[model samples]
Target: YINDVCRTLREEMKRAGIHAEVHAWQKHLASISRKLEYVPRQSNENPLSQLHDLVSFRILVDTDNECYLALGHIHALWRPKDGRIKDFIATPKLNGYQSLHTTVFCLHDCLAEIQIRTHDMQRTATYGIASFWYLKDRMGKEGSPNSWKLSYKEMVTWIEQLRQWQQELPESADEFVEAFKGDVFQDQIFVFTPKGEVKDLPRGSTPLDMAYRIHTDLGDHCAGARIITNMDESGCLVTRQVPLDYELKGGEIVALLTNPAVHPTRDWLHFARTNAARNKIRRYLKTYERESQQADASAPVPGCQTTTMTIHAQDRPGLFRDLTAIFADGGINIGSVSSTVQERSRAIISLSFHLPPSLKETLRALLHQIQALHEIEHVALEPHDDTF
Candidate 1:
């Protein structure tokens, strides 16, 4: 039945002067078994009846526009099954599969599935993102024109997005398997950045997840979300605050607001859905709390007249030169310097300075200045234990 549909489709496309290669296949038994796990147990129902793509036909073309053109011609020839059409080319799958799928009744009233995609898309569908290598091999062997080459730029972008998804995936075997099925294999929702770039995220992802996907620092400093509703008649954007726990929907443009003075809190972990966002929040909170504890332990006690400032950074030529200059500008004289640069370009420097009672209030501003210096990773101030 599907073979006849494929023949008819090829003949119709040929008549229309649309060049395409059509292929047909049945679903593998292993794939059917894996799908059976999800289907509910029915006493009288045949398991095969539940599968939609028992026999499928694929149409391959040369360009994205040709995919739609093929789809339109296929629809014109066959009466499509109501509500059985899906445009995966416009919105690709989570794994970057791009094809237009439709199930139609054809050839003695048997249902058959048809997929339309470009030649490059067919290669990607067959080989996943590794199709670039396959296409390259073909180009090398056949000396194909540059136009025949599959663009690696889109493949690279998908690889980056997959990497971000992997970071947030579950670690344990059972949890990882479940997350793979639920997150990676399922249909995804699309959201937009402020610049109108589309981002595919798992369903139920929140604003914090979007921020973390963009950058760790952005997630750490995320204060709120601005949901772009639409443009006003005056051409200004109308936006509303989307709460931290709000589930994002498709096509909504989200703008993440960041506050430099704010650091991530442990409470953020509870609301964060993605592993990437939660892990980053926890890491930042751990570092922040540790630094706070260190500061408390190093606070100046009564009768302490000296202070020690610890600086950590990546070592470079003349990196510490600016530190001495900053001290001179602040009118603080360094009494002692203990410093070391590790093999991996990591530097730790401890500087001791005499602190008078009158200058105690001004010390915080000086410490802030040191922290803001380029190449400095961390700055912590403590009372010098040894009396000067």
Candidate 2:
């Protein structure tokens, strides 16, 4: 029965213009090493039987861009039910899986689940444990466990970067994974960032997952998020103070904010519901706790309030130096500065400083002057009332 089901699904995928490799396994087979080469070595028997009702399918591609192209192909071949198509290559699963997935009714009342992933992602999913072993075998003596470990670490880092990009762009992490899991893996959702990034999240994921996918720091310091959609031509999707638990949709972008003093709450762990988000929240809390302890050890008094200013500007040759000069000319002691360029053109600068009542006017004037520059868009003043 399972073999027949797998064959039928494979034929259907082919009829729909999707190329898929299918493998079948018998229960309790003896020394089935030959079968192992074709099969994933993991039992997919149930998914085969469940078809579209209980299980889905995923396709692995070669590049991040190809993932979306595959999604377009799937949707084009089979009319996607409203809200059934998802793109998660931009946003990955909590376990660091990335793919594009969808559920569609194929010919002859067969519901099919399709998953699309990059080649690298496909290997990661199928051989989660044996990836390193395979690498070692391929490289012979050079492919030692240590080499595999290094490769694994590099893969993890790449996934982390992708997760961060997904969070910053759109589609909560859970939604991205959910789309992949549900329709493809376990009934998941795939969302895209504003810049066409894909995220695979679980079904019913919230914006908080999006925040964490961007960075642990963003997730830990996350104060709120705004949802923007491609349909919103006026760009009025900036609904502020959005509830973290609000259900997210595909093609919507979420902008996340972080508050320096805000620590991750226990409720966040419950609400987040994704390994990536939960782990990030915990990491933030741990880091914050350690920093608090160190500060307590060094400080004469604790919990002093501080004030900071963040500036956003276009990337120009002298933008950083010019901004720093403004502060220097004002005789303001610079506490710290951090900046990141997005898409290689736009830049965001964050500066922290000790607030002196007398320097308030100087700071205001300096900010005003900076704002007057053609490259500068807006400046935000953040008061660190808890840290004096």
Candidate 2 Cα deviation (angstroms), residue 355:
25
Q: How many clashes does each candidate structure show, in the order listed?
A: 0, 44
Off by over 4 Å in 1: 1-96, 99-118, 126-136, 145-150, 153-187, 229-238, 299-388
lDDT by candidate, in order shown: 0.72, 0.61
Structural RMSD, model 2 = 18.9
Indicate the worst ten consecutive residues by lDDT in candidate 2.
230-239
Candidate 2 C-alpha lDDT tens digits along 311-332: 7778999888888788789977
Best by lDDT: 1
Colliding residue pairs in candidate 1: none
